[model samples]
Target: MAEPRHTRLRRRTLVGSAAWAVPVLVTANAVPAVASSMKTDLAVDVVDPPYDLDHWRPKDEVPVYRGPRGHRIAARGSLPPSIRITNVGRLTAVDPSGSVEIIIRDYGNDRASSAPGRLKAGTTNPSVMWTDTTNQSGAKYKYTCRGELRPGQSIDIPLRYFVNPPFLHAEFNVLVAAWVEDQQEGDYDDNSLRIGHVPWISVF
Candidate 1:
């Protein structure tokens, strides 16, 4: 026997509805896949820069001499050093306002104990304070310095301090770093530049 006309119409309607539903479900699942593909493309475009050499300017000849224990021999280079820093805030005289920090390391990768060897802000610290590098093998030194720059104010750190280097074959580099200070306790800020190498020379 033939089926009723009403039943035939119901069957047709159900089949059409399922066909449309399949496309909608497929499209819904495809959205996440499309977003994932776009994310991967964006990640590939991100690239980090290599090292810069010009930032680490080389000196002609750095002098090597000796000062008495607990005493520092200061030497001022003829030319001043220039550095560009970022991530630092205003150059006010307040906590976290922005200041300068200088560190010296000996050729043997050890901190040198030179009395009165410090960089004084707003002026020459010790006006040529020196370090005794005499008789010290591999007696090299590196200066790691950083400063916070306030708006419209720039600080120029002259290559003024010198050490009485001990070894003639000693080699060293100077790195200038800068960053904003974190107000939180125990959490330091991230450095901006790992300046190229500043070759240390002797003026014997």
Candidate 2:
């Protein structure tokens, strides 16, 4: 079932396509609907993971990457997972074109860079945050691509994910973050997104 908007809490009032966030929340969502306010100028999002880009990419229903054959992502975590990208800004996200940098975070590390600034817990729904993958811990990897992806445009990341392991069950927190250089995102929020995983497992 979808969650009620009233139950959803954001650091700031989201304008543009961010106004409607999916029910995907962590324990932190129970806080007040408004806080001091967090903001980001960064213009792209990982619309949804787990649903796999090739199979289902949501836009009108909700919102929810790339690569050659323009941009691609390495599947990591408890994943064979793929992420979708969307340009949610009024202006185009580009270095004169579309330049996107992505970092795949490990299951539970919630650092503000490359990882979610806020800790979220759930499955399938994508969470977005603002981060720089400068110093990340655990099994994480980074990917980037340069092209022209206009505002409101989306691209699905190709499936090429891998996970390093010791042992585990089927469930996992599949986390990822994206950003563009030269543009400063307003808050340490929403340039990154994460979701829990279903059965399919790949271990090293």
Candidate 3:
């Protein structure tokens, strides 16, 4: 039988200490609804990871490495699971160009470095963070990427994701932040979007 959503949320409420009422609200949703106040200049969309970019590469809004277009891609937490990017901005723009790819680099023993793991199936501990990496395809556009957000503008990035490990449980939530920036580092005018992943509950 499928685990009750409330049961799953209870676990997060306990571990995440999210909020007293948040779990009740989340449990109430038969479908997730975007929060009204959280909307920013960028439209964020979360979707299941893609299998291959061959189909995604043909989109019209696919972000090029360099263009006059400026974007802020930000996500938080270190995890090893699945997450969907949803559009939260008022802008109805879509990432037809397929220019962005999420990359996770294990920070390893270096506590000072950034943790870039994806969402996981089970177990939440030692919270970590993820900073966007510039084009994994070695493409960097030279356009004047600014932090200016117009209505209905956003970057929809699809990730090809999977978790391989000492399989014990199915998934867990990894906290993360995101931004629309030209490169992985430095200060871009755009503010980082901090989002927390709901536990990627166990499937096995």
Candidate 4:
């Protein structure tokens, strides 16, 4: 028996539709693979403020009025602390163009304090007072940079903070936390680093 003209036309239409569907399915599956391969993996590591110190003694000790005994005292002065961040990733990490933001937090329970200041990368100044949002858990500061952080590339930031009267106590602790922004992180655990229970002392 010969096939009818309408049946033959329907078969040709189905064949044409199937031919286009094959490429669409294949493309859908291939796009995710290509995107996954291009993803940028970034890791941030804090390279300053040594963690294993038996004790971080004050550079200078000043006696305050006897209000509370055994107050972990920071000299009534300012300390210049150096913070270092490095990109430990296989690909380059680029911050949003124009400015790079770095946030530092004090996770210690005693009291909240942070000094915010802008310093050029690789430069240190003792006069700059690092200030932070009052009573906030963390302080964020932005800087101008090239924004391209290649693997293993590191930048050092200099910061300064005044040793106010209230921060002097025997158990006073100055915990420092640091992180970078604008990178596709592989492990979020390594994106930020914290050093806690640092002895609150003055380094003038």
Best candidate according to lDDT: 4
Superior by TM-score: candidate 1 or candidate 3:
1
**Candidate 3 minimal-lDDT segment of 10 residues:** 5-14
> Candidate 4: deviation at residue 109, Å?
8.8
Question: What are the runs in model 3 whose C-alpha is more than 4 Å off?
Answer: 1-152, 169-171, 182-189, 192-204
lDDT tens per residue, model 1, 1-204: 311111101112111121111111113365766433321000000011123247533333322223322134333221224322222322221222222333333334534424213222122322222232223322222222233223334333233334433423233333223333333222222223221222333433
The sequence of per-residue lDDT tens digits that candidate 2 reaches over residues 48-143 is 433334644211121111111112322223322344555544344442212223333232332222332212111222222212233234223344
Q: Which lDDT value does model 1 have at 133? A: 28
Ranking by TM-score: 4, 2, 1, 3
What lDDT does the true structure give each of the candidates?
0.27, 0.33, 0.25, 0.34
- Candidate 1 accuracy as TM-score: 0.29
Q: Weakest 10 consecutive residues, lDDT, candidate 2?
A: 58-67
Better of 1 and 3 by lDDT: 1
Model 1, global lDDT: 0.27
Report the C-alpha lDDT of model 3 over 15-87, residue by residue, as the tens digit: 2221111111222254345433323322122232112256531112211111112232122122212322222
Q: What is the TM-score of each candidate against the true structure?
A: 0.29, 0.37, 0.24, 0.42
Off-target runs (Cα >4 Å) in candidate 1 are 1-80, 83-151, 170-172, 178-190, 195-204
lDDT, candidate 4, at 86: 53
Residue pairs with clashing backbones, model 4: 70-170, 71-169, 71-170, 72-169, 72-170, 115-130, 115-131, 116-130, 116-131
TM-score of decoy 4 = 0.42
Model 3: lDDT equals 0.25
* Clash total of candidate 4: 9
Best by TM-score: 4
On the 0 to 100 scale, the lDDT of residue 14 in model 3 is 13
| Cα lDDT, model 2, residue 21 | 26
